[model samples]
Target: MKARPAFMLVGAAALTLAMGACSSSGGGTGATTPAAAPTTAAAPTAVTLTVWGPQEDQVDSTSWLPKQEAAFEAAHPEYKITWKNAVVSEGDAGKTVQQDPSAAADVYMFANDQLGTLVQAHAIGQLPPDAVAQVKQQNSDVMVTSVTGSDGNIYGVPYTANTWFLYYNSSKFTADDVKNLDSMLSKGKVAFPIDNSWYLASFYVGNGGTLFGPKGTDETAGIAFTGTQASDVTKYLTGLVKNKNFVNDANGAGLAGLQNGTIDAYFSGSWDAANVKKALGANEGAAQPPSYTLNGSPVQMKAFAGSKAVAFNPNAKNPQAAAKFAAFLGSTAAQQAHYDMRGIIPSDKSLASSASITADPVAVAQMNTVANASTLQPTVAKMGNFWDPTASFGKALLSGDITAANAADKTAAWNTALNS
Candidate 1:
């Protein structure tokens, strides 16, 4: 794990309180020994900082979050920790915090895609120069890129590199067998949530479709949803939906099917890796999602890559304490704790390739996917338009609504949606 050098804590008063004691009873010899006067160290001023995250992290006593809180308090004796259970996700932070900045948690874990909005709303504050340098030195470039604002300021420390890849029952599919989606579908059931826009963006991306241009900051450039490349992928998806092996597992139906043995393979990220592995047992294996044939050429399927980051609230009652704790939460030890406790994939390069992460199929799949083949989820507000359109396009494709004759109309509607 990467060494997370935190703030320099000063506790001279606490150390001085450790004075020695003398025998008060004189070994019961009836000689009264005068008790030494007790020395009390001046108490440090207490500062309470509020934090937020998923329910599991907030509620589980054995979870790493509480452990992190304890350790943070131990390091900074003057500050105390208070956790608030909130479902506010990264995408929700901007609008929600903008409504009531004082109500927002001091330090919260949010997705990378919402960084732009958070910065726009002024909900999150910029990282100090040293913390920014530490984040860059510790995490991958892709991760660092996600949290950086358009102004080129670092806003948060990333905790997990979130992305999807291929997972198959190793006992049923060989390494080569897992390389092609066509082959995997031919073997039987494979759960791919075609209705999900997050996953659908991958096909468009794989087919050379760009969303909000390369860096994801160009709103006027819009997205690519009506081109020939899109038609190729859509047509490809249309064929697969009719295949008996295809299963539309939106809203976790795919994962459930995989666990219940009705599905042979699943396309998802690290969050579902542990449960899916439990379902597959020794047969569990994972790799990057396989390619599909498009116009006689194989098109590599891409995934919407993202990260879970810790952002310090600008309205924090204790900005200094919040910043210090935010650094602690993203520290290498906390990342490893998250894995050990919740099996979350680590973003730090040290923990990303560690034995614990590398040995696990889920973590390995994510690491390989992010490093080799994945498209960054655009962080601009315009990205909100891409999700529904991609999902609707997938829904139409699955329904066989995009035949050659109707492809133009469907493409126009999809493009209109994208432009909206």
Candidate 2:
């Protein structure tokens, strides 16, 4: 999950009471009848649910967690809930929950990359039909895919997306110019973190390479980074590095360059929005990743995308309530509140389409990227083998050790390492 500052969240509650009086007359005109026997309605069910989320959300009584808890309580007056909240960051929720499923929070937030682990441990429950419909209806396909297990079941409700997009200086490149990376490079200095494995695969992915499977879940399929297309991408990167307008962002070079005005554009995610805004001021422009020309055709650069989502523990005492609350946390209204209160960009499509979200370029670009120009980062355990080897290849590219002459050989070796 992105490291963000905490915000205050206040919950509003509304209750309605209905009153009625009844009387009956035995005779038409003269006789008065006794009132109907007094009756009492059944009491609401009492449910105690333990919820967990990042410390940022639980920082105070007015934070996102408390506000949502209060709202859930108000929304469902059928259940009188006693809330127990703990500080467990989304990134660590799966591991912690797996340690003791019986002791885990009934409902919790987690990064989508942990879905497989949670599924393997049977710690996360499959969303109910209503919740499943909401998840598909409210979110983009990528957000929906992120929380889906290998067995094709929806496991959670996604709230915010995790992905990178293009941040540029509007003064240097127009909207048309931003459509193609080569165009941006020709116009002004551009920085890309080719040496980082996280950003390195964008080019290859754009040129028809894939991780795991098309959806990134078929472990037997492995990585598809060899063959002609992958080699072509390698050759393209070789030339891209030699371009005077291109700068390989290593360490903090990209942001540093943007800060110093040496860089006109860089590739990054929402986490860098504030810093990029501060650096560019009036000229800041954000957009989905641009395409690069491959073998004379334009291919869209696709980043690895995932989501931060809410899930219920199947083993919880009140599984139904836990599931309902989990769905509520990722609901459209809840996501809108999350964005408003915490500046957390929402993954919910309704909120993404709202005027409030569209006004923010970073938020718009992120949603656009996730919806149109990104691949799902798979949660399979073998995905663990991908990083170190890809990073090594990226380093080699940055070092200029793999030129067009050796791009094919080097590319083949990288593919081998990925599968190995």
Best by TM-score: 2
lDDT of 2 at 155: 97
Candidate 2 at 294: error in angstroms?
1.1
Name the lDDT value of residue 210 in candidate 1. 82
Q: What's the number of clashes in each of the models?
A: 0, 1
TM-score of each: 0.78, 0.90
Model 1 spans with C-alpha error above 4 angstroms: 1-47, 58-62, 73-96, 250-253, 404-409
Off by over 4 Å in 2: 1-39
lDDT of all the models against the reference?
A: 0.77, 0.89
**Model 1 deviation from the true structure expressed as Cα RMSD, one decimal place:** 10.5
In model 2, what is the error at residue 377, expressed in angstroms? 0.7
lDDT of 2 by residue, 150-227 (tens): 999999999999999999999999989999999999999999988788888888888889888888888889999988
